[model samples]
Target: MPIHGNKMKKVFCYSLIFGILQLIPIRALGWGFKAHRQLNYAAVFTLPPELFKFYKPHINYITEKAVNADKRRYAFADEACRHFLDADHYEKKVPIDTIPNAWNNAVLKYSEDTLLAYGIVPWHLQRVQYQLTKAFAEKNLYLILKLSADLGHYAADLHVPLHSTENYNGQLTEQEGIHSLWESRLYELFEPNYDFFTGRASYLPNVSETIWERFAQSFAALDSVLIFEKLAGLKHPNKYSLQSNGRTNVKVYNEAFCIYYNHLLNGMIERRARASINLIGSLWYTAWVDAGQPDLSNLKEEPLKTENNDETLIQTLFQNSRIIGRKED
Candidate 1:
């Protein structure tokens, strides 16, 4: 049967709409997989020759596996709290110092349930830093790589403003989907123009204090993140458009609107991304130094004995504890 005129025109129109919809991205959590990989990839270059030599070869593993923590969120109930901390939920506008730096102290003061309910990123990161340091001390190639990749994910998460807020996805402000719009969409669009050269990594005098400081910086930027999105919405009336995801139509920020929002943000996304890169590098270097600067050039490349399954990794990392908290996407 030969279709012509109106029938052909209708088929072409429907095809075009579907094609365009495929081009738009669905919402993602925590900087998206692309940005996370890029951050881990860039951080490797910031290492000194001593550390770089060892990391250079396994850089791909680190980069590709940087999203493991994010993946663990879906498999393990306990993994979600490790990626973010809703500080405002604890005490709005309080100094970061008010929260205990040590996990034991935090558990004592806030109770384990309370800490888990809000989030435990800063605390969990410190624990992982110690684990990395121990891995370095023992010269365990497998644990070193595994812990390093996980560290990069959590450290990068701390740099996101939404990760530090109660209104992480902007459901509170009626700016839903702003999480992915800022961290994932903008980076996917403008990352080519970003400057990733953050110089060499440095040793932190105090790891715990430094982690708290980074969280504070991210929290301080939360207001700007929310406020500017609203401003961008007001400036661009057609802020959102419906796109099909093969399942159903969902609202997403318009491309032009994303550009306008990025412009209003004044390079904030890039700065934070660079910050994440630098922080990841610094933490890796710091852990190695704290572990007595092991000679990695001669360490044996032993494959990790674990099954490489999500559940296996989660059990190994978290011990399958029951996590009680609000899992913020």
Candidate 2:
């Protein structure tokens, strides 16, 4: 497998973990979940499907005080890691004077670390999913917005390559801020023109494959992201910038960054966005299927399952954390 192929695997693992984390209760889980980006319910605007069948007309009817409309207010406790790969110990493994691409030949040197990062992601997602479902069952209802947020979080994670690795930011390669540079910065800058032609319906039979495939494609770009980012840093009109709020004086982006970066991504940005939109929709569809096809028309049942399930996930994690804490003590 290519070096980035390994990293892509890590990103897939994170999605599964995020799904698990959604299982926790809102109170226990806290507001950290918002760190994950919200999914667009606008997808439903394009097609009226199962859940929105009867409720279709009122789909946009602002439900009064049911679910929080502003998702950005809530942040997933574990989500901060999504913006950048955790490489605190790299200073020990790497020399202080090192730049990102310095280790062109060192990709495999940290293979184990890369694999470990990928492994942690899924558990977190699943934990959250458990909580969200239970929470919805409690009120005997599911909030489309909240559910979309959770679903989107996992779906988005699937699309991020660095989420799949220890070198998420390309720190090993000196691409220190590549994670946010690509996921956050690049998207924020180019999202307006991003392609919406993801097409109709999905083809994946298994959820795992869906996750890995998306992640692998993302990971495949790691090299280009890392190497090209460096090139961008060196090429832009004194501003081929990155994760840093673009307004900064970082000359990391220019015609060069655009050229090489796009080449590296192989024109996957718009496609990836489309995939993200569709994946969230598909996941929502699948979740309903797993719930035995809940009647989303009846507001009384949907959000209840979402919230109540979320509460349960929170409780489980607390219990686990307590156990681990006591052991450590």
Candidate 3:
């Protein structure tokens, strides 16, 4: 069968659009990469003199590699689950007290499969904190830096309201793309004025309890995150505008709509970002303290080699199965 001119043009256009969409990175899930780097960079100053002196020398690495966890989602099949926890998946109304704070207990009650099926951010955070503490104890400079960067990424993720819910991207509420609009787009526009000066980091006696508390706070805010966005959409029916990404035109929330949305939220993004900064710094400091306050100032800075074999294997498995934990995209 021979195709007509209009049909041929339609086919070509659709192919071009799909190609452009493929160029868009799949790692745009959690806090935007830009925001993650900024958060990690600002968190360094919150450390005490002992830790700050050591971290200051390689602050660039800490900031730049903060998005490694997000990048790993493509290569590691289980990595996606560490970025979020769909609290509502557990029960109606999301009773924080009913959910076990400890991983072992939660796994016992809900089964590991069930827990991972939704997400395991809060529990995984404690695991990373332990790894960081062990790295500090061993004074393994490479692991310390790598684990610190990973820790910061997860800590920031925990503060996002969408990360605590099943409808993370608002796909369930007919407001798809709200995840990026709330965390990424708004920060791109208004981050310049956000106050990142979260005082000095503090020690955490119990990491598990502290993380669960943070989870609860984020879950509590999920309602407003959804409702206000709905209200904003009702107010501005023409909320999106076409913008070029150097390759093709894409729909994005307009600046005016973003400004209006931010107004409705009343600095909620700024507050959460500040809290993330504080939590990252505090977790780093706490890990150091728990490791008996290691003298990091004298550790040798050894260049770490990049290892991608495991990542390659995991990526192969992911492609074969085409299954992943909850994700924004």
Candidate 4:
């Protein structure tokens, strides 16, 4: 939790980091994205093939909703929790304690939103699992896919630093590129090393503290992203230059960008990697738990039962999954 001044409380915010337009590689100013798709892809490979009996269907569900993020359907759907999700919900000028009951209600509402957005993954899984057991309810394909979509979106959101920040994409501070740097460029450079494979699920402990920690890390990183970039840009404006490779000329990632990013990001890469891996694993496990621990088999066959039925199911799942698309804050 932010150290609330005893005086009065005013601001509460969540980062909106996902919708950036471009990925700029200015050396160490952002993640080198050395890992790219490696870790997540590896996690998929590690899943027990037999689980594909279930996994394949979920993948199909998410794929179908892949465009929803762009369409802002999720954002609209998530508007229900806007108080907690929006960085603007809290006060910038005053203390939190000074706020009236109206603000308190806003904070409470926000708390619920935060819970749903960040922690809904496991719950979604659990719900599906329950339905699956209570009379072969797997046929509720729409519910399955829709809820899965929400989870995918939330998971992706968690990886984004700006998603956890009050300023989010930096619209609040005029530091817009910070969103892309945290998600896109970082994924582009260091994603390969992220250990998406965390084995099977485990019991979930109380996640309140965990979520708060995530917010803190992202909020903290925003300073470095903005400050270092500005400081570096001042001293070495052109220190970053792009180079042409055969296929496409990549930004040669300037020294200033690297130096500044490293200065700000520091251990965030490793911290994020560990969190990402465990989070994925935890979500999967929670889903299984929520699913009432149904045996991988014995569940009914695909609803449509087409040869490509798996494809359809896979397209239906979401909140977080493979970077089939753009980065989140």
TM-score per prediction, in order, is 0.84, 0.55, 0.87, 0.54
Q: State which candidate, 2 or 4, has the greater TM-score.
A: 2
Q: Report lDDT (CA) for all predictions.
A: 0.82, 0.45, 0.84, 0.42
Which residues of candidate 3, in runs, are more than 4 Å off? 1-28, 307-329
TM-score of 1: 0.84
Output candidate 3 Cα RMSD: 8.3
Tens-place lDDT per residue, model 3, 1-329, is 98789778656744553343344434236788889999999999999898899899889989978977876665567898898888898754545977898899999999999888888999999999999999999999989999999999999999998988888888888988898888889998999999999999999998888888888888998898899998988899899999998868998999888988899999999999999999999999999999999887788867564334334544454354332444345
Q: What RMSD, rounded to one decimal, does every model reach?
A: 8.8, 14.3, 8.3, 13.8
**What overall lDDT, based on C-alpha atoms, would model 2 receive against the true structure?**
0.45
lDDT at position 1, candidate 4: 56
Best by lDDT: 3
lDDT of 1: 0.82
| Candidate 1: tens digits of C-alpha lDDT, residues 1-329 | 99899779757754553343234332224788889999999999999998999999999889978977765654467777788888998767747666878889889898998888778889889899999999999999989998999999999988898888779988888888788888877889899999999999999989988889888988988888999999998999888889887888987788889998899889999999998999999999999999999888888867655335643644443343222334333
lDDT of 3 at 318: 39
Residues 1-329, candidate 2: write the lDDT tens digits. 55477467655644554554433222111112322232244444333356546334444432221122112213233333322222333432222222132223224555544523323333334444445455444424345455545555655555655554556546567655465456555565566666554444443356644654565565565455566666666656355444443445443444446656666666565566677667755655555555555555556432345445444544454444221110100
Off by over 4 Å in 1: 1-28, 242-250, 310-329
